[model samples]
Target: MHNYTIAELVKGLQSKQFSSVELTQHFLARIRQFNDQYNAVITVTEDQALQVAQLADQRLATGSAPALCGVPLLHKDIFCTKGVRTSCGSKMLDNFIPPYNATVVENFEQTGAVMLGKTNMDEFAMGSSNETSFYGPVKNPWATDCVPGGSSGGSAAAVAGRLAPGATATDTGGSIRQPAALCGISGLKPTYGRVSRWGMIAFASSLDQAGPMARTAEDCALLLNCMASFDDKDSTCVDREVPDYSASLNKPVKGLRIGIPKEYFSEGLHPGTEAAVKKALTDLEAQGVELVEISLPNSDLSVPAYYVIAPAEASANLSRFDGVKYGYRCENPKDLQDMYCRTRSEGFGEEVQRRILIGTYCLSAGYYDAYYGKAQQVRQLIEQDFVKAFADVDLIVGPTCPSPAFKFGAKGDDPVAMYLEDIYTIATNLAGLPGMSVPCGMVEGKPVGLQIIGNYFDEARMLNLAHQFQQVTDWHTQAPEGIL
Candidate 1:
């Protein structure tokens, strides 16, 4: 039951091969057995999950149940869950539990999906590695010593470890794709406004977008179908109609143009990663897909521009967490000023604080025009670059990260090296386009992800290509040793 994909689970439930309660129990038991090993789950709502499963079973008994009825999934901690700890992996909000469900959580509930628990994340969705998580870093299932990619790492790790079939995750900049690559799972970052952000905790509001993470593209597509919906509550949510993402999974692949950016294959990419991406491209080519060399001229400036823009937004968004509000207030402050200073400094992790400082500095009156304004201009240029490349290509393909999962603390001393880890993925967020990562190959036993970048609202096409590739290769099905 734990190993079954969401699609298979759906069928099994429909056929009454197992009740939702039974399936939920199997996953609950697995979480109990393996969570300590991976630190993937931060909370276990066994009692709540079982109770929900009973309701799902009742709905399943009816002929007209929701699409994901009886499916159990995890949520990244960044999303608010009513009556459950919605810590966002930071001590600041460790004691905070929301009274309302995030739109993503509400959507899953509407599908009759049982919530397993919340997964850890980098505090406030900052950091390229999960090391900044206040709950402690989520270890990569592939190699316990290796770091899973950041912010969304726990979601990716939980899915990869088979603790859940699928989970919700967000990407401010490559948080979903990078971890999915390192943890050997399929994760999607939908077009910025495709999903509602009403109850999701903000990081870089303009760049943050939530999507699904699972072992297969088929599962991801199914999850995405439930995850995306326009909500008026969120000002950033798009009003466009949400399509059935799984409907196009088997779409024909012949003659589809895939762009290979020269910058993605340039210096600093690990040799193993480049080889794996090339082989994946070749496999697609063999299936009649056309590979075209393209140039994203302004892509080179994406990292610098993103750092400036994201932090600037983050600074403004996180200001609400000051001691005057509900989260983590300092005790016995000499005054309100002392309280605000101590609360944030003590509540946020080092990485979160560092970004906040950088953001505050950039947004300061004297520096705003020089740093924030200039970065916004560069961001526009980067978006234009993608617009130009997509003119002749259906999608763009590249390595999700410069390398596979690195050993914990490998780049802790040098933040620039850590920041560059997301060099390949930040552009998608900057452009507010959809992107996904699917397991393509392995490097030194760690998985490599092949990133697919699609035009806005073109997620179905991206999933179709990913599904086609998976059908020809077993990479997406591969699990970490001892996981099963």
Candidate 2:
């Protein structure tokens, strides 16, 4: 049951091979067995999960239930869950419980998917590795000593470890894809505004887009069908028709043109990762897909531009947590000013503070034009580069991370190196395009991911391409040993 993909699980539940309660219990037991090793989960709502599973079983008995009627999944702690502590992996909101569900959570609920728990993440979704998490870093399932990439590391680790078939994750920069690459799973980031951001804790509001992490592209497609919906509560959400993402998984990809950017293969990429991505491309070519070499010259400037723009947005979004209005407050404050200073100083983790300060500095009156305004101009160039490339190519392919998962603390002291970990992924976010990471091959026994970037609102097409590639390769099917 734990090993079954969401698609397979749905079939089993409908066939009466197992009850929803039985499936939910299997995952709950797995969480208890292995969660201590990775610290992947923050809170387990076992009682609520079982109750939902029981209701799903009742619905299943009637022979008329949703496709994901009983699937169990983990929600990244960044999402607000009604009655459940919605800690955004920060001490500030550690005790904060929302009275309502995030739109993503509500969508899953409507599909009758049981929420097993909330997964750990980088505090305020501000780090490239999960180490910045207030709950502690999430260890890679493949190699316990290595770090799982973040801020979606917990969700990636959970799916890769088979603790859950799928989990909700957000990608602000490379949060979803990098971790999925490191942990050997499939993760996707929908086009900005394609999914509602309402009730999701903001990191870099403009760059943050929630998607799914799962063991297979088909499972991700199934999850996306439920996750992507426009909501009135979120002004940024696009009021477009939500398509059936799973409907195109079996589409033919014989003549699809895939672009490989010259910039992605330049300096700072690891040799092993490059070899793996090349091999994946060769395999795709053999399957009748056409590979075209392209140039995204502005890609080199993505990291610098992202650092400026993301933090600027984060600085404004996080100001709402200044020791008042329902979060952690400092004790024995000297006065209002002292309370504000002390509460923030203590509540936020170091990484979160670092970003806030950088953000504040960039948005400051004197520096706004020189820093924030300039970065936005660079961001426009990055988006234009993608727009030009997509004119001749259906998709863009590259390595998800510069290298495989690194050991914990290897680059923790160097923030620039940490930021570069997202070098290949940040541009997609800057352009507001949909992207996905699928397991390509292994590097020194750790997995590498092949990133697929598509045009705006082309999530279904990207998922189709990933599904076709996955059908011929067994990389996405492999799992870390000893977990079971």
Model 1: how far residue 269 lies from native, Å: 0.4
Model 2 per-residue lDDT tens digits across residues 1-484: 8888899999999999999999999999999999999889989999999999999999999999999998899999999999999999999998899999999999999889999999999999888789998888999999999998999999999999988999999999989999999999999999999889999999888899999999999999999899998899999999999999999999999999999999999888999999999999999998899999999999989999999999999989999998878889999999999999899999998888988899999999899999999999999999999999999999999999999999999988899999999999999999999999999999999999999999999999999999999989999989898965
- Model 2 TM-score? 0.99
C-alpha RMSD for every candidate: 0.7, 0.7
For model 2, what is the error of residue 205's alpha carbon versus the real structure, in angstroms, after optimal superposition? 1.3
lDDT of 1 at 83: 95
Candidate no. 1 TM-score? 0.99
Q: Name the runs in model 2 displaced over 4 angstroms.
A: none
Best by lDDT: 2
